[model samples]
Target: MYSTWPNLDTKTIHQQVLKWINERNNGLQSQN
Candidate 1:
């Protein structure tokens, strides 16, 4: 995995994942 990923730090990756999840949740909430 490190070979494929190379340079991203864990904090950056975690923030991106959290942002993605929040966007998805907001979309779902808006749909309801």
Candidate 2:
């Protein structure tokens, strides 16, 4: 994937990882 403006992929990947972690945490919290 690519953005219209030039940018590093690390930032995008980091944001995605954060979102994934948040979703996982929510699911775990709901189960508890």
Candidate 3:
């Protein structure tokens, strides 16, 4: 995810982290 997302700016990194975290959360919820 982060590998493909361009994180050259501070805001982009923050958004990417949130995006990655959300995906991880969704995956965990599906397992339950």
Candidate 2 lDDT (Cα, 0 to 1) = 0.81
lDDT-wise, the better of 1 and 2 is: 1
Q: What lDDT score is found at residue 11 in candidate 3? A: 78
lDDT tens per residue, model 1, 1-32 = 43455688777777888999999999999999
Off by over 4 Å in 3: 1-7
Q: Write out the backbone clash pairs for model 1.
A: none
Q: Write the per-residue lDDT of candidate 2 for residues 1-32, one digit (tens) a residue.
A: 44643565868877878999999999999999
Q: What is the Cα-based lDDT of residue 25 in candidate 3?
A: 100
> How well does each candidate superpose onto the true structure, as a TM-score?
0.76, 0.72, 0.75
Q: Using TM-score as the measure, what is the rank order of every candidate, best first?
A: 1, 3, 2
Q: How many backbone clashes does candidate 2 have?
A: 0
- TM-score between model 2 and native: 0.72
TM-score of 1: 0.76
Candidate 1 regions with alpha-carbon error over 4 angstroms: 1-3
Model 3 earns a TM-score of: 0.75
Task: Please give, for residues 1-32, the per-residue lDDT of candidate 3 as tens digits.
Answer: 45665646667888878999999999999999
Error of 1 at 17 (Å): 0.3
